[model samples]
Target chain A: MTQRQALSQSTGGTARGPALALDAGLLCILLVATPMTGSLTLLGETLRSALLFLRELSDWMTKKKLLAGSLAHYEFGVEKLAQAWTLAIALAMIIAGLWIAGLALDLIVTGESQTTSGGLALAAVTLALVTLRSGLQMLPFAQPKPRAFRFASLLVMQSMITLAALADDPSIALLADSFGAAFVALLMTAAGARLFSTAAVDLVDHPLNRKSEAYIAELLLEAGVEEEELLDLRTRRSGRDIFVELTINPSRAGSFEEARQRMGQLRRALAEQRDDLDVAIRLRAPGADSG
Target chain B: MPGPTRDQKSKEAAVLYTSLADLAVVTILFFFAVFTSSLTLLSEAIRVALMLLVEFYGLFVLRALHRDRLRRFRFGIGKVEQMCNLAIGAALLFSGFWVAHSVVAALLSVQAASTPLGLAAAAVISAVNLLINLLGWLAMAAAARDGDSAIYRAQLRARAVKLAASAIVQIAITIAALAKDPVVATLFDGIGAAFVAGVMVTIGFKMVAECLPDLLDHPLPGETKKEIEAALLSAGIAGEELLRLRTRCSGSLPQVELTLAPAGCASVTDYCRRVTAVENHLKDHLGGADVSVVVDARKPAET
Candidate 1:
């Protein structure tokens, strides 16, 4: 794909890579199956999941003894149930919108399976997907870009599946399925390749090590250590950890006892700042200042 | 004076050749993915494309700055590296979120379908990614011998994200094969994707966090601070009378400001001369020193 197309596809655009692949697979099934089997099978599959969800919900509620409670307790349970129910409703809406859009797109493209329910579903789903995608795309930052495209792909695939369910000609469904499969496969491969390319780039630098080293240097300076008094100042990284080595001026730092106390304080401060650093402070007295 | 030292020429060639090789490899990978016709493959290819864009931009900035190719940013373009680091983090975050969202959708829409072809494709992609990751590691090892380089770190982070994603895809494929129930298979797939996404997000956040302090002008290293104090003392300022020493790094350069007491009665010219001398000494010692020194009249005992 061109860079622009790839960008649009990666972000929230009409093209959804993985979802489109799924649509192709579903399209193949639709082409092979008659309308009676295609649409009805989809309906049956949807119903089966819905029933399974309800059964699980029922089991959970029974286990929790949701109904075996006083009026106040019952009220609290209802509040909790309402929150869950709201989420379930939203999920149902998105699925419904997707199913309708799929049916509508198939009808439009194939010039078949045009029914009143299909028409209404198409219009409603189209409007919903458009509004949702637009709204999501408007959100600040890159957070919503992938999500918006995901919604778009869902709409497209569902629309294709709906059309496949209603299509009278097996050939059209098969053709769409084949095309979709090829497209999806191509998209996935491209994505994998992108990942591979990124994998090839491994940075050799450790910026964190540098920063920590600088922080340590500042600590020593603030502790009354002369800059020139520090000898063999070295900092490096071993994996994720930073190692620091420096010599301090002890003679200028008052008594030997005081210098030791200052070193302790500096070490404590550094530890508090970064739990990952290994600092070694060597004290050089007046005569021992690398004469 | 020389046309270019042997080491300089070698570095120049390494940078140029590496960029070209990287572009060539990714371009070839993109084409290969196009022919493979796998969603998982394409998804990664898109990431690599975006990565190449960021990598090249970072390299371009780095090369220009190293070669003194940019007049506007003559001081340094360390911030460009920071910005690139930020971009890489943001990109990974975006990809992670994308993968998570897709996984969730798939989990919700679990269907009873066997995807042998998709599984095989994912396996192939995983193998290829692992191989590339291994190669990247070797390159990293070679680079590390020369001291920790920022460019290599960025590349490592990016490589890690892709490696994790590939490994997850491989796991998902295996799970799909073992799970008889399509729902179970879909669940495993979703979980694998989520795991990979989590890793990507975590690494991305870490990279961004690490770069922030550098960009924000964090204080100079402790050793550098000690060195600054030593430089001042050696320049005739006594350490006991030195009231305060403040130091920070701006870009790749050291910046220092100090307050000290002069030894004897000195004229304004004498003080300026001393400050200039200290500044010159710092520049020589610390390298690229931006120094500010003030002679305070009060001694340590008085203060």
Candidate 2:
């Protein structure tokens, strides 16, 4: 990619890299040492076993008059050991969710097949891939940049959530009730695609994108910075900032400050340039560099 | 004359080329290991092949960052390097997973290749790789002599690590090739490759983080503070007050805020001179802390 494209993509969140590395390493260490920590995990498992035993005990107690109390041992066992084992559980949840959802959908939807377990696996993998990369992208923000792609990406994420909720399969009720992986992935993909399309438009230096269009419109209304002759305007985002390098034919001679302040004000309303526009008003003697 | 100047950067680039050569030679050996159908040789060659990217990645990062002052974020493109680093790490990690997959497949399958040719290639490539590593080692040692060169020094250290790892891989490949089993060779090579990639991803991740912290507006070095603090203290003020300080990496110098000890406290000219002096001190210490003095009475302690 060109440098501009790369810089445009380098949002502040990329700083997450160090934290991710640190977190992953910590997770691995915890996974390796879990056997020694037979404290919480073992306790939970023991409680689960006790609960199972009590189920039998309670039935017998009900029949006899002596010890008639039901010993209800709550067993939410093995849930606390969210180490590498968490990954296994996540995989399982993904699998079970897919299997149930697919079966239900297949029952209702004529053309759909319940045996697309592999596709469900692929969906889980895809989500994992996106999440993993998104985490890395967040790493840049640690250092702080003047601009970032927060607005665009966040819009995309939100859309995914909305689309997923509204998405309908042929067996819509079954898919929704069963909470299938296929259903989740499908909605997510549709939402993401919508958001990405907008982002893509923004990336291509679309002047009509909300920010620039507002900026140019604002500029036209300004009496101070407006010149009768300004043309071939182009603009693009750099992180949170918007840079515009265009030629203007001023209405007669004017103070440079007057022109600068106007353009500066316009910049502020658009991106980081709005309140933090760093303006470099270079004077052009009509025929400066080219002519 | 203080140091080798920009030439040091060129030398680092040269070091990268040398190490990549070592990898290329090892890859040649790798092909033979597969051909000879020696489990050990194939595995060893695969191991070496796996690590090739790690060496290349170090080169890429070191070479990219080895120049110029920190550019102002106003241009917004400086962070492009970080993006490139992140992209590269993701690619390497994905490739590592692929390498692991292949290893598992080979472990289960009856895959084999021709052997005698692989052994001869391994021998030849090992000698060539050793030579390349030596060149890289010399370049690294030369670069490190300039202790003041933080960026170049980092490059040197990264290259040295690659050189050491490549040498280790070469030894393993030779041993595996002698064992005469292709499966063993594939296993050794595949595992080794994945491990090397893991290391690269981790390293790349870290180096990028260092730069990212600055992007996040994390506090920079205190040289600017020292100047501001010295300026306030120069006014003969009593007690240690921080005076408000805000800093951002703008253009040429980082804009630093140094709050004064309030109105009734000290000589403005002397305070101003001291502030100016501090600004100069900051500019010297912090390649370019803009040294802008903001006299804040409310946040006096931060000065």
Candidate 3:
């Protein structure tokens, strides 16, 4: 495998992290902005109550009698729904986390102590949900669940607090924000349940993406190495990275180091296409038994 | 480039001609209604104008797209819809704010004034507007399906939104005219305009966001990255860097640039042979990729 291809695999296990982080950031902003909206506080709760709704939706879609069982990412009768639910749940979790954190910083932690219990709980739930989803995404690679679904609990509790707030309740803006997060999350979950009722895995042809193919062509065209010396070529793509195998003739040389030098040049050229690629170069005799 | 299919070309011409005809109808009606200061006639004329504007927008967009087919989102032209969404969304949002403002004010100062001729005008306007909008909807769908342009897509969406807006306004006008409440009728128009604005703004925001990643240069699909690396490895070469790769496109073809170490060939002829092999390998994997290779030995190597 080429070094760029190897790097892709190594990094592939972590690509979802950024996506999770982005979602978390978006949620946090929404949750924090809740208290500022005053009468629009219910809008914020849209997020807090979202997690349970998503979980319920996921369960309904998967029909997984129990949420505690070990289910592979691929297996399911309603896999598409499950996948959609998972994505929604994960997205909600991230959003909730951001909301709670923002709420905590903006109102919960600094605000009155007694009124914040609900907000704190919902934030915790959101965190937990986010952690669970992130963990699942990378489980095949091995790592701790990124965070706890603290936002969910926080969202639910905050929502109740918001209800209280709405009816001449205390100044639990923090709680209101958490509740907003939950509410939005729940609504999204419900909507997603209807829209997505199965796991989703995208299988696509990759090498056709143009960048990889062109890069390879450039290397060979520029290398100035004889096409006759080049015996065979094979390429396969999985995800964004392409793995290449080729065989070429070894010309008369004073030393094997010269051939090695030529190989190094080729490697350097390939790297130009993508530094994060895995490349495997195999030297073989002409017309030898090759797979 | 594949020439436009016969049906597609014919449909394109029909859509354009029909839109123009619709515009002419709107103009004639508008003049006829305004000559007598008929509010009902005026409302119908406005609907016709909007429909004409939408069609023209679709036509121009289609023309531009056909002229420049290379413009696309990654490998496809998905970004056109995305951009249109942003612009329309913004327009809708702005329109919504304006309509809301007018409605709030009108509600505060409920005024009733309608030309005595308004009763006769209302019926004519309602009939004309309804007919025009329905025709516009059909024309929009045809243009949208036939032309792969953001304008056509936006026109389609705009028509759908207009349908709802027009329906609401129609209901409001019908009730107000029955009650002889001129203020309510005016209020309905303002609200309809506002609704259009708000919808456009929402669509605009969505488009802007969808297209942001491409502008930011996110990596290509992972499978593509691996394919290129594997091709290099299979060759009798090793230690090559799949250096900074940029995937761009011209029309439908992908353009790839791979910077690599200079060929370490004993002779220039031998060097050309090796490069040709890699090029062939790339072409085999990715059809019609324009590859550019730069030879620079000293670079940060990835292990």
Candidate 4:
């Protein structure tokens, strides 16, 4: 198979990581920032609560079945409803996260506590929960399932990096502003790279699209337009639209009305086969410079 | 039929609201930047201000699109959105490159200052921006649920990106606030600014690439072309030899043109009937397509 075909086949798998990675990258910045400014008093519990909240959120989402399992099986207008539901779910997660954070903040500001070794376990759980939450959050935003998977993978990467950073020193603030910036920069670069690659594919004609031109040629030939009568035919596909051009010589001469009648027959014949054909037909004599 | 569909009108209103909201936010940000001495704040404010202006112009384009759709213009100005993509893409790219440069310079030589108030202000603005964008996204998403319009999809993406960007800014600013050292805070601020820019540029670049084909009037996809060709070919009449065929698409509508030479001598009636039949056939298949069939007496010279 050609490279394009190969890419097309594996698009499902390839699409799974980037979006997740990008989301993760964003979360990484957030996770890194959390402990930087806040009081360390409730750090473990707050993070642990955050993890618990994510688990509950995930379970709630699973129970509700908010996201469509397969977008294709659904009818056209229905997809949007699913999309809206997903958006609502994402919004709800954000609101919930904020609420939990507020409660955590209240606890931290009101009371004082010492840092404990449990901080490590809480941090790990938080990382896992955040990764799961990020994936769910991105689910509605991504169109195809594979793209969602890709996004989840990216989120995982981001979560891992942030977890590593947090693991280094939970008490003291790390002057790692560059790290956040670098994480974002790296994600952008990766996004840019993907864009360029996708652009390359889009710029060229897909094999299926190319086949359409030939298909048109075959259809005309099958319609009994002799090879000699057919002057020129051109076909091109633009996104979801199609363009076709055909030229042929007539076998008989008659008045304009008679000619139009004959053209009518041809059009009806073509229409019977396909209803959504945008066709323009031109008639010319055998030796004319122009029509 | 008499006026815009409920969905269309709602979408238009949503776009208008977002554009105005963006303008307001950026204006507030600009004033905040003016009062603060942070280079990062000033730069981002300028960047966002440019974005709002571009979005304002985009609102005009959306208006044009609505008017065209209402009038049922033969060639809709749908591709005009491509221009928005181009403009926004430029802004994002410029911001990214500029911010990258700023971050590099900061890394090489740091200018240390304490601006807790500025950081606090940015954090608040980021929160407000986030709220605005989230609501906008919800509105647009709901609007999009009825039918998938390219404009709606674009708006959705834009709102989501804005939300993400705002959240990132808020986090970065808060981190900077927590840092003990002034240089460390500056570094964090620079990083956040750069990250936002990077995401913008990446997305903007993709937008430009996606719109280029539409702006350039690229050919329709293969399946659509095949459908059109099949309809025209099957519509052919006896004694009529197909000569030349050409097809193109404008927005969602397809257009096909073909040359045919009728067999023997044909009268005006015959020509009319033939052309009418073909036109009708095409109309039936490609409902919204602009189809035309021409009969030519003149033929190519024999070699």
lDDT of 2 by residue, A113-139 (tens): 332333333333333333454456567
Tell how far residue B71 is off in model 3, in angstroms: 11
Residue lDDT tens for model 3, B1-303: 555665556446755766766677788788887687664456546545644654665566566556565342223333333333433443444345445555565456764534535634554665565566677777656545543455555655656665666666666556555555666556554555466556645654564455433322234455776776676677654645454455543223344556444346555335545565666667667775645442333323542
Arranged by TM-score with the best first, the candidates are 4, 1, 2, 3
Across residues B1-303, which tens digit of lDDT does each residue of candidate 1 receive?
224444444444444555455566567667877787545555556666666677676666555545655433322345446656766776677677767877776656665444866655555755665666555555544444343246545765676566667667777867776677777776676677788889888888888777654444446666777877787778777877576665544345555656554554234334344555666677787766655553332323435
- Candidate 3: residue A234 lDDT (0-100): 48
* Candidate 3 chain A weakest ten by summed lDDT: A197-206
- Evaluated on CA atoms against the true complex, candidate 1 attains a DockQ of 0.02
What local lDDT score does residue B192 receive in model 2, on the 0 to 100 scale? 55
> How many pairs in model 1 have backbone atoms within 3 A of each other, for residues 3 or more apart or on separate chains, i.e. clashes?
62
Against the reference, the lDDT scores of all candidates come to: 0.51, 0.42, 0.49, 0.54
Off by over 4 Å in 4: A1-254, A257-291, B33-43, B67-73, B112-114, B181-191, B221-227, B237-240, B262-265, B276-287, B295-299
- Place model 4 in a CAPRI quality band: incorrect
Q: What is the TM-score of chain B in candidate 1?
A: 0.68
- State the TM-score, rounded to 2 decimals, of chain A in model 4: 0.38
Comparing candidate 3 with candidate 4, which one achieves the higher TM-score? Answer: 4
For DockQ, the strongest prediction is: 4
TM-score of each: 0.43, 0.41, 0.39, 0.47
Global local distance difference test of model 2: 0.42
CAPRI level of candidate 2: incorrect
